[model samples]
Target chain A: LAKTTQPISMDSYEGQEVNITCSHNNIATNDYITWYQQFPSQGPRFIIQGYKTKVTNEVASLFIPADRKSSTLSLPRVSLSDTAVYYCLVGEDTGGFKTIFGAGTRLFVKA
Target chain B: DVKVTQSSRYLVKRTGEKVFLECVQDMDHENMFWYRQDPGLGLRLIYFSYDVKMKEKGDIPEGYSVSREKKERFSLILESASTNQTSMYLCASSLYLEGGETQYFGPGTRLLVL
Candidate 1:
């Protein structure tokens, strides 16, 4: 299992773009970068995932450099409802299994 | 859409009492996991199962035991509940190891041990 590091908290205004970065210096070759968004009292929801380069989805985009040691989760046009904790994980895509969730980045979207 | 259902949404138990937390996945996933979420500590894995009756200890398995008698259900047991054991219990299900599918999580069970 690979350990991950992310910001403890962040603040963004409505309609602004927000990007949260995660570092996994000890990342393994078979590992993939996946991001999840969790609201209060709700289970974390899958946002985006990437092996390398960029992977985009309907909710967010994941940008991973060639180094694969770090990745960024970009949320476009943030809304008040977007205020939540975002988790970055590095693990083998075994059914998204065997993942370690770090402290995660808490994003506060203000109107 | 994958549906992972937990037996209870909230539970309150007393110390030294036996407790059971049940989780079921309708997707027929072969892998199920139990995790606990705390304030300062992130999510810590308590246990996981690859197949029916096959279980593995996770990062923080102390005082926690799991059972998987059927393919779609996994249950976490606390032999004797303690105050520190009170936390948000999460259950997740994933496809077999070879499939590399994403794990789907249930709504979670909030356990408050008095």
Candidate 2:
């Protein structure tokens, strides 16, 4: 499993864009970057995933550089409801479906 | 929508008592997992099952055991509940995908052992 590093916390106001970057220097060739959003007292929810370049979805966009060693999760026009912890995971079929999640980036969306 | 439902949202148990956390998924996914989340530890996997009656130990499985009697149901058992075992437990299910499996999680069970 590739170890990931992200910001401990980030502050953002409404209508502003929030981009959280994750670093996985040991990323493997078969690895895919995935982002999950977790609200207070709730399980993490899938936000966006990408292998390389950029992938956009209804909720957010994932920007992966050519090197694939890092990825960014961009949330447009954030709101207070978007305040949550975001986790970045990297792997694919890690023997016996073992997945690892690191301490996530806590995004605090202000009014 | 993929839905994973846990038996309880909040549970209080006494020390030395047996505890069971049940999780059921409606998607019929082949893989089901149990994870415990703490203040700074993030999410640590306890156990996972890829098929019925087959189980695998995760990173932290010392105090936890799991049983997957059927495809949609997976249960985590705590032989003797302790105060240190108090934490939020999350259940998830996913299908094995070539790109990456997207895990659907439940609301989580908050366990308080006193």
Q: Which candidate leads in lDDT?
A: 2
| Cα lDDT computed for each candidate against the true fold | 0.88, 0.92
Predicted candidate 1 versus true structure: per-residue lDDT over B1-114, tens digit per residue: 899999999999999999999999998888899989998677888999998999999899999999999999999999999999999999999754432357689999999999
Write one digit per residue (lDDT tens) for candidate 2, span B67-96.
999999999999999999999999999866
Per-residue lDDT of model 1, residues A25-103, tens digit only: 9898888877888888877887777788998888988889999989999999999999999999888855435788887
Off by over 4 Å in 1: A93-97, B96-100
After superposition, the stretches of candidate 2 with alpha carbons farther than 4 Å from their true spots are: A93-95
In candidate 2 the C-alpha lDDT for residue A97 amounts to 57
Looking at model 2, residue A10 earns an lDDT score of 100
In candidate 1 chain B, where is summed lDDT lowest over 10 consecutive residues?
Answer: B94-103
TM-score of each: 0.96, 0.97
lDDT of 2 by residue, A11-87 (tens): 99999999999999999888888999999899999998889899999999999999988999999999999999999
Error of 1 at B96 (Å): 6.0
TM-score of chain B taken alone, every candidate: 0.95, 0.97
Best by the TM-score measure:
2
- What is candidate 1's DockQ? 0.53
